[model samples]
Target: MQLLFAAPARKPLQVDRHLRRQIVRYLTTCFEILSPAAEELIPDELEQWGQLRIGNGGDEIHARGYHKLRPDGRDAAFVRYELMVDQEADNPSVDERLEPESQYGELQHIFVLTIPPKTPKVNPHRKKKRHLLLAQIYEAPFKFDEADKYKVIWYKGKLGTGEVVDALTIQCVIDAGEYLYPYIPMFDSIL
Candidate 1:
């Protein structure tokens, strides 16, 4: 009867130049911040792992699947989050060390990595357990309007990918009822 169980589903790991750069940046930034876990990971090891489980947890600890990233403080994943991407601020005009500052990017996926407790005991430390998060993300480069500082211009496109972000990310931002946008490429005025 055990054979009846389905094999864990996995998508092909397609890391293009942009994604690769992002991964490298993520790793480098993590290391600079003194993250011990980040220190262990090298780019060469990504191919070593067969799969990176998404959507649901693979272990008993994080088996409760799918938390809606809402503003209600229910889930760790936020819809429109300013993801801390960079470790340093861009030329801070104030008294600050020439160091990394919290920078934000667009959030793509939230991986809640379940780490078993040391010494084989149930870990009592559950203070914001979901905060143990790894996020797949992207950032749009922005330029303030020359004449009108109030207006901002930024780059946002698939950059060749079929979809810019997961549909769930969009769904979370929408109202309680149904809402719809044009298919693929639409709207003459916007673009």
Candidate 2:
């Protein structure tokens, strides 16, 4: 006899315009300051990968960049950048939106930074875990709890290949009134 099992339901991944720009700006600025040399390499690298475009924004800035193979052996390659904006009306109540789950109106433009695992060299004691890029903000009028920081929310999205992925260390959220404007602390670092 054949047995039947229940399949779990999946949550939807929302893409916002303002959030996309914020992510691109944040990552671009970060890379510019972190590695100016790398910034100059973006154009060339991007060409070899594929075309990029904003997927869900009115300003043709929703999506940016394409995936490419890094020098390492990982599932995916390269970073996909975009900003996510939780509009004023979307913000959930302090009680509900505290955690990444129920929180609404949390605009989060995510830079899907993907780095594949690299092969070891002479030492042979190096093995890196696959990393996916993700960052976001949870903005609410009233402060719910101290545990959940406004910045950094657990986000999940699907890749171009339709493979499900999860991104950690996703810390980057906009303030209540600051729509589309990211708090670029490292802005001055850009030359």
Candidate 3:
């Protein structure tokens, strides 16, 4: 029952993404992906998390983390979406300097959609499925310590029940943190 857009329109922006094992390698266990909206329901808990303390630098606070931000915070360096799963995964095993703190838990992996440099006509084939694209990546020693659950929001598109076909949510939670490594166009053309 996830809404795709906030307004109705004849032409809607669509997205899709498929990652191979390489993408998984970049993200280790511990962290899980979650939808921006679903994360909202648990706000009170998040606020309390801020009181938690972390790091050798005494008195520093730790709070619940969030994937997305509000319009004002839209300028945020990266946009995040949920990657839900049934069970806990292992902690990310990438280079330590490249990872967020274990307290954040390894909850990496977000999907985004981009228009590229040019807006080509939407292909009929590409429209068949709900898609997500990887627009950017984030590294560790992150800007924030814990996720401010209240900060992020979910996708609020207007699909109505009929126009919409399918919706699914996977919730992954890790004790470590997640990682995101953008997919590079390994080749100039898929020749």
Per lDDT, the best of the predicted structures is: 1
Error of 3 at 102 (Å): 14
Write down the lDDT of every candidate, Cα atoms only.
0.30, 0.27, 0.23
Choose 1 or 3, whichever is better by lDDT. Answer: 1
| Candidate 3 lDDT tens digits, 1-191 | 22222222223222212222222222223223233322221122111111211123322111122233333432222212233333323445533334221111111232332222222231224435323322112222222322654322121222111111011221112112122433111110101
Clashes of each: 6, 22, 39
Candidate 1, TM-score vs. the true structure? 0.32
Candidate 3 segments exceeding 4 Å error: 1-75, 85-87, 90-132, 141-191
Cα error of candidate 1 at position 14, Å: 2.7
- Tens-place lDDT per residue, model 2, 1-191, is 11111221132233344443444454454334333432322221111112122223211111112323323422121222223334443656633322233322232232334333441221123466433334343332222333644333222222221111122321221222212433211110001
TM-score of 2: 0.22
lDDT of 1 by residue, 21-136 (tens): 55445544533433344333323212211112223332111111222344453322212222333334565674534542222133344333233333112233544231123445
**TM-score winner:** 1
Q: Which 10 consecutive positions of candidate 2 have the poorest summed lDDT? A: 182-191
